[model samples]
Each structure stands twice: as C-alpha cells, then as structure tokens.
Target: MSTFKAPKGTFDLIPPYSATYLAVRDAISGPLRRSGYGYVETPGFEDVNLFARGVGESTDIVTKEMYTLTTKGGSELALRPEGTASVLRAALEASLHKQGNLPVKLWYSGSYYRYERPQKGRYRHFSQVGAEAIGAEDPALDAELIILADQAYRSLGLRNFRILLNSLGDKECRPVYREVLQGFLRGLDLDEETRRRIEINPLRVLDDKRAEVQKQLVGAPSLADHLCDACKAYHSEVRALLTAAGVAFEDDEKLVRGLDYYTRTTFEFVHDGLGSQSAVGGGGRYDGLSEMIGGPALPSVGWALGVDRTVLALEAEGIELDIPPATSVFAVPLGEEARRVLFGLVTELRKAGVATDFGYGAKSLKSHMKNAHRSGARYALVAGERDLAEGLVQLKDMETGEQEPIALDRVVEELRAKSA
Candidate 1:
C-alpha cells in the first residue's frame, strides 16, 4: 500500500465530497457579493510581527499557534493564523482604505494556518469564509455584517447555531473593567496560563472553559456592568438592530475575544453539539485595530466562519447538503468508430453548457450500462456502428431503464428539452 498521507490536521476534499465544500463556499460568498462586498486575496505569509502585534501578544494564536520561519534574508515570516490582520495589511498597502469610501467592505474564502492540537472542528491548517468592513465603525455596519452571516447560514438550512453577543466596552471603559476583573481573578484558584491571561487582557480570562475556573469566576465583573455611557448606547443600538431584524442572540458577558485590538463589541457563533470546540466561528467590533496596525483611525467589524466547522454542524444536525450531480449525461459508444465520433460530440455538448461524460474503454454493452447506472447520470446515450449508419442513437433513461432511438445529431437538443 502507498504510505504517503495528507499532512496531519489536514484532509483532502476529493471529488463528490468536494462538491459540498465548494457549494458551501459559493453560497456564503454569494450574499456578500450582493451586499456590496468585493473580493480580496492576501499573501499566505506575512511579517511575523504583523500577526504578533495585530492578533495580540497575549493571545494563544500569537504566543503558541503561529507558524513562523526565519528566512535566509534574516527576515521572520509566519503563515497567517487568521484573515483579518492580513486583509487589513493588504488594504493599507494598496491604499484601498483611502478610496473615499466610509468602509471598504470585502469578502474572502481561503485556507489559514495555525500550529495547534488537531481535533474535531479545529485543525492546524483549516479553511475560513471571512468578511471585513474596514474604515467605518457604525453600529449599523456591525449589525449588517452579523445579519449577512446569519443569512448565509439560514440559506444553507442551518437552524441549530447560536449567536452569542457581548460588548467589551470601549477604550474608556474596558481598561477600568480590565483592572477590576484582574484584581478579582488574581484571588481565584486558576491555572498559570489563564492567570497570565488575566494580566494581559483580563476579559479573556472570563472566556475560560474549565468548570472549576468558570464557577469560581462566575462572580467576576461583567463588561456590561462597566460599559461607558457611549459604549452602553452603542451596544443597545446593535442589540436593537439585531432584534428588529429578527436575529436571535444571547447576551454573553464572558465573550471577551482574546485580542488586544478588539473593543466596543465581541461575539461568537456556537453549535451546541461541538463540545469543547463549540464555537463554529465569530467576530465583532474592533474600532482600534486599524490604528494599532499603523493605519488611519478606521473603525471596523468582521467575522470568520470556519468552513470545516460549518460542515461538522451540518453533520451533527443530520442535514444532508443537496450537492448536484457531477455530470448530467453519460455517453456510451458501442464500437471504436462510435467512440471516436461520440467523443467529439460530448465535447460539443459540454461547450453548450451540458455536463457530459463518456466511457473510456471498449467494454460490453451491459458493462457500460451498469457503469452508467453507477455513474449518477440522468440519461445515457448509446451509439453503435449500426445505429450511426441510420443517423440515430439509443437514449436510455438510467433511472427508469427505458430506451429509445433518437437522431444522433438531436441527442444534445433532446437532453436540453428533457432537463428543461
């Protein structure tokens, strides 16, 4: 047996199964396009400091999950662990932020890398369908992005996901709450890693998943309790917009995203069945990130939904994606002459927007028929020397096992009529 395998924490999306993945990506990106979000692609690797500084030095993504390498040129580069920072950097480098637009709305779908423990819904290498609106920080913009994500999920018939919302307050209030939260956490029984989180960004400490730690810190100060007047008003407006749009969300006071630049709001998307990796994806307001990244003072909000986690959610709910068939018609040539002629005809059919496939080898009629049955084709066209001499071919309905003679030149037209 061959010994080579896909890299750990990565799997191949082979044919048929790959169809579902592509469908999900297209479905998610479709709404974003209609919503005035353009597509953008960024470098897979960037200066290591881009992530360490933008993603936050305190977060696990920078401190532990980053895949960094030292180049011969003496520069340190890292495979991007997330999309937001790369997108922001790309926008700034290209001056897209200065296009006289309030917000540069864009969407991206691609692979991201992280060095971490591989588990269900979590991979060292994974895929994300992320959206970002740079340049403006209106509560309405945040609500629009959230609603777009919601629309994408619902369009896929997903109903079991939860949108967890919270306001981490702004610079004015978050620091005050951070100090109070850290003081309270310092006195609690916690692990060294989490205790350090309390020091770097105490709000992230509230995100701990340990039961004991959770229970001990249930009394910890909530961001809601410390929201400044302006922040409180902004949070209220976002909640109101979501509610008015019929998007349900649970107020999660502990949903402090582990990023130093995130402010005013934070959120996550969770599926109950995912256990410890319950978060399918999430994003929220980061009004100060642009300034931190050496860009203009732009306020923005965005989210990255794990495509792998999304597929898992569909599986957990026992919902099957209706991936379309690979080909609509299969051509069976009975002889060498027929094979040569039908080969060209199939190409013509495909050129006319028909999905067509043809048997490659010279096999028994019954064998090809059986193969056609197993090929997932709606109709099979059989052309033999005798039928070709008569300017006709046999049309077989693989589903009903019915067959008939049609003019060889009319096969494409007949298939179109049947499909329509």
Candidate 2:
C-alpha cells in the first residue's frame, strides 16, 4: 500500500524554512503591534453567508475559491478564504465598535484556504499576516495602513516591491462609473463568461489578465475620470499623506483589486520578482462592508500580506534572513550517573534563560557530539563519569574546536558569562 501524502494543491512547512516564514510574519506584524493594533484571532472557518455577503457573491473568492461544508446540524460553513471579511464579522459580533475607541485596530496571522490551481507563490492552503482598522472614515487612516505595510516590507530588507494605489469611489459616484464602464465593456469581443462579468461587476473585467481580453480594453474608460468631487478629494488626501510620509506609490487608476467590498482607497504591494503572482499583498478601504454584512455603518481599511509569496520574493532577490540558532548549547552526558547530573545542570541552565538541548536516548560520545554540531549550538557541555568525579564538566566551544574544564558548581555562571 502507498503511504499517505498531503492533499493536492496543499503543502506543509517544515524545518529551517518554517523559521523564515515565522520571521516574515513577525516582520509584517511588527509595525501594527507598535501602532496600537491589538492581536485578534477568529475561527478557521466561519458562517458561509458571512463571506458570501461581505466579500460579495460576484467576486471569485466567494463564488469559486471558498472551501465550504455543511454541518450535520444543517448549517453551512466555509474555511476562511481571506482575512478582512471574517475579521470585520468578529469585530462587529463582539461589539468592538460600541467601545469608546472609534477605530478598533487589529492584527492577525494565520493560514487561509482557497481552492485555486496552486503554483509557485499561490497555494490551496497559505499563510498571511493581516491588519485591520475598523470604524474609521478618515483618509489618514487609509494612509496609515499603507505606510505601515511599507514599513514592514522595508524592515524585511525588501526593496523591489512597488505600491499601486487607486480609488474605487463609494456609493455616490461608483455607480456612475460602473454604468459607463459597463457600456464600454459590453461592446468588446469577449467570451460568454467575460460578458456575464461585465454586467455583474464591470470593474472586475478591468482586472482580467488574459492578453486577448486586455487587447480590447485599450480605450476603456478610467474610473479616475468619473470620481465625484468628494471621492476625488478623499483619494487626493490619501495620496498627499503617503507622500508626506515619504512612502512612494504609483497611481494605477485601473487597480480595482479582487475584492468587491473595497471602496474609496485601494492599494496593492507588488514585487516584480514574483512573475505572474506579483502581488505580495494588497487591501483598501471597505467603507460599506459593515453594512453589507448586516452591521452598523463602520468604515474600515486593512491589508493581508502573503507570507508564502513574501518568502518567495526574498529568494528571488537572493536575500537571506539572519535567523539565530534555536539551540545555543547542547549537553551530552556519558554513563547513567553523568546523565542524572547533567540533566540537573541542563534544567538549571534552561531556567537561567539559556537555550539548551540535551543528547537523548543514551547515544555514544561520538554520536552525541555529532548531534551537537548539527544543532548549530555555540557550545557543548560534555560530562563523563570521570569528569563528574572531579566536580567538573568539559565545556567545548563548537566554533573553535576548543575545550576546557569548568567546576560543576560554576557551570551555569561560566556558560552565561561566555555566552554574554
């Protein structure tokens, strides 16, 4: 019989590489943590209609990509395909909006599921670090989210990413642009599905990547041209704030992101290094998303950075993260008596805040030393029966191939001083 394997389109994160993924997540969430964004977590799966209504029935995420299931109790649920909608739902359910704070800033990191055809940077199961600022309508809030994301990428030493900014006018003006865009899209030589999308969400047609479809969109109307006075000023203020903060961005009038909830400010972080899956992260203001999901009119903005794609981008640029070793010291005890003594020392060292590992399974000295070397430890504490009898342990510096005898009572103090 064949051994089991991970399901198709999904992959596991293991070992040394998982460390890099963790570092990327920490880097992305660092700015949010410092800027009053509290950590928030939601269920891996949520009520199906939460997404269906919040993310919009017309978008691909809700219609094609979501992983859904029916419970034995006859309730429908879906593994969260993205972070924003679920986060908003959680915030509203808990009445975070009712609190004195107008905007409930939050940060989250976790895996999201989507039934997409997996590729290098895209996966059926993927990880993201996301931030949300709920219950605010100020343009500065929009700019703040964008600036924080920029700071995160820079903190990771990434320089090849570009920010694409756009404005999807809110209720008052977007309808006018939608009508004009629809009229233009209707006349295009497109397939049946493309035609259907034009009527449902014409802006999404602008996001279509096919060369044939793009060719006919050459003279398509620009949303920037139809922005109402209020929307134009709001978008302009967002641009000014980003510029004042020295965050560079390009105005991409056609960037209507994949989500149907976004309105007013929309921005995407794209890296040229990642080929077709260039978008490492993106988000925008979803001013009406709260109402769409049956909550109060709470304007919000947020972004989710793809951890898997960010790691890929790091490789593309040939950058390595400086991750310290997990184990700083390895303890190898020889003989049963030495094992008991050294185990006590190991516990004491660990309590002293030293990262220590031990040689388990009573391995030979040679095997234990080899394991110590593989652990990336800076020092190894090797104690045999003879050394213990002398009230001593052999301290071996893994780096310089040097060894010295230290009094057993002073082991912890000596190691701490050496490490310092």
Candidate 3:
C-alpha cells in the first residue's frame, strides 16, 4: 500500500517554520489591533455570486482560479479566493453597518483558496492577514490602511519592499478613460482573449505581465490623466497623508488592481527579492463593493498581506525571525516512582506559567536526556527514586552544562524564577 500525501499544489505548515508564520501574522496584525481595528473571522466558502459580482467577471480570479462547488441543495458556493468581498458580505449580513458605526473597521486572518498552478509564493491554499474599513469614503482612511501596512513590514525588519499607488478613477471618469484605452487596445495585434478583455475591462490589460502585451501598452493612455476633479482631490489627499506619515510610495499610472470594484485609490506592496511572485500584498478602495453584493452603498478600503509570501521575502533577505524555543524545561524521570513525582512537578511547573515538557516513554536516563536536548529546552529536570526520597531533583542547565540539586517542593518556584 502507498502512503497518503497532501494534495498536489498544496503544502502543510509544520513546526519551526509554522512558528515563523505565526510570528509574521502577529507582526502584521499588531498595528491594526492597536489602531482600533477589531478582529473578524468568516467561513472558508461563500456564495459564488458574491465573488462574481464583487471581484469582477473579467478577472482571472473569478473566471479561472476560483474553486467552486454545488451542494446537494443546489446552492453554488466557492472557496473564497480573496478576502474583501466575503468580509463585506459578512459585515452587511450581520447588520454591522446599521449599528451606528459609519465605518466598520475590521481585521481578519485566514486561509484563501485558488486553483492556480502552485509556485514558490503562489499556492493552492495560502494564508493572509487582511483589514477592511467599510462605509467611509474619506481619503485619510485610505492613507491609514496603507500606512499601517507599511508599518507592519518595517516592524518585521523588511526594507526592500516598495509601495505602488494609483487612482482608478471613480464611476464618473473611469468609463471615459476605459473607452479611450479600449480604442487603443483594439488597434493592437492581440489574441481573441486580449481583445475581449479590452471591451470588458481595459485596465486589466495594462496589468498584463506578458512581454508582448506590455510592449503594446507602452503608449496606452494613463489613468492619472483621466481622473475627475473629485477623484483627483481624493487621491491627492491620500498621497499627501502617506507622504506626511513617512510612508514612501510610487505613483504608478497603470496600477488598476485586478478587481472590478476598486475606485479612486489602489496600492500594492512589492518586494524585489522575490522573483516573479513579488507582490507580498495589495488592496484598494472598493467604494461600490457593498452595493454590488446587495448591501447599501458602504464605500470601503482594505489590504491583504500574504503570510506565505512575506515568509519567503524574509528568507530572500536572509532574515531569521527571533522565535523563542517552545519548550523551556524538559522533565526526565528515572523510574516509576520518579515518573509520578516528576510528572506532578511538570504539571505544577506548567500551571505556574512555565513551558514544560516531559520525556514520555523513555526508559533510560541517557535516552530521556537525548529527548530533552532534541526538544530545544534550556533546562532539564531529572529525578530518580533516591533523589525524590531525599526531597530533591537535579536541575541541569542545558546551555551551561551545570547541574544542581533543588528541594523537590520548591521545583515550581525555582524554575519560574529562572525562566523569568
């Protein structure tokens, strides 16, 4: 019989590395938590139409990458490929908007699924830490989200990532610019799919990474030039706020993120260290998303930072996170009576806030000590029948190779002080 394995294109997060992933998530979410953003969690799957209407019908995420299914009840659902739409749906469904809070500030962390060809940073299943501020259209809100994301990366000691900002022009002017861009794109020698995208969404063509498509896009009309007066002022305020906060960014004229709902402001964080999959995270002002998903006109701004991509970026920069050892003390019992006594002490130590682990099923002292060393514990507690009879246990400092006998009754107090 063959052994089972994780599905292709998906990988499991195990110990050591999983610890770093957790630290990265905490670092990214720390600032948001301090800034009045409350934590939220939603299901892994949502109504299929929610994404189709919110993420855009022309984008690859909806048309190609989404993992969808139909239930026995005939309801179509999809594993959420992105965070914003589902989050907005949840807030609206819960009547959070009607609770007297104009902008419902929320942060979420979870796994999102996509059926793309998995690469180093791109996976079938990926984790992200996302933030959303709904029901507000203020430029400061946009700037705040961007600044927080910047602070998060900096707190992680990441220095090479760059922020790319752009204004996608709200409902008023975007249509005019779309027509002009479509006219130009239609003239280029392109495939049928590219030509079709020109009609549905010309902005996505500008985001096309293909060398041929990019070459043709050199003379395309810039969205910056087509912004309406209102959008121009809104984008200018967001830019000024970011600059004032010392959050540097580049004004990319073609940064129409691959979402249909984004309006006025869009930004992405890219790291040069990662080869092709360089976008560690990005989001924008989806002012019409709430309405698109059957909710009221709750304008919003949000960003989702890729936990997996950020970890890869840390590795590319040769940066190792300072993660403490999981086990601070390993208990090794020499005999049956010693096991009972040591186990009791281990429980006591744990209750006193010490990270303690016991050497289970190891018979010999040498074997138990070896297991203790493998646990990455700083100290080891060894107690035998004779030692317990004398009301003492040997405390061995794993780092210094020093051992001393302590009163068995005072084991918990002694270890707590040492750990502190």
Clashes by residue pair, model 2: none
TM per candidate comes to: 0.97, 0.98, 0.98
Error of 3 at 389 (Å): 0.8
Candidate 3 off by > 4 Å:
none
Candidate 3 lDDT over 84-139, as tens digits, reads 99889899889999998678999999999999998889999999999999999999
> Tens digits of per-residue lDDT for model 2 on 274-383?
99999999999999999998998999999999999999999999999999999989999999999999999999999998999999996899999999999999999999
The number of clashing residue pairs in model 3 is 0
Question: Model 1, 273-378: lDDT tens per residue?
Answer: 7778888889988888878878888888998998988888888888898886787889999998899888988998888888888888879988887878777999
Query: Per-residue error at 252 for model 3, in Å?
Result: 0.8
Model 2, TM vs. native: 0.98
Better of 1 and 3 by TM-score: 3
- Report the poorest 10 consecutive residues by lDDT, candidate 3: 1-10
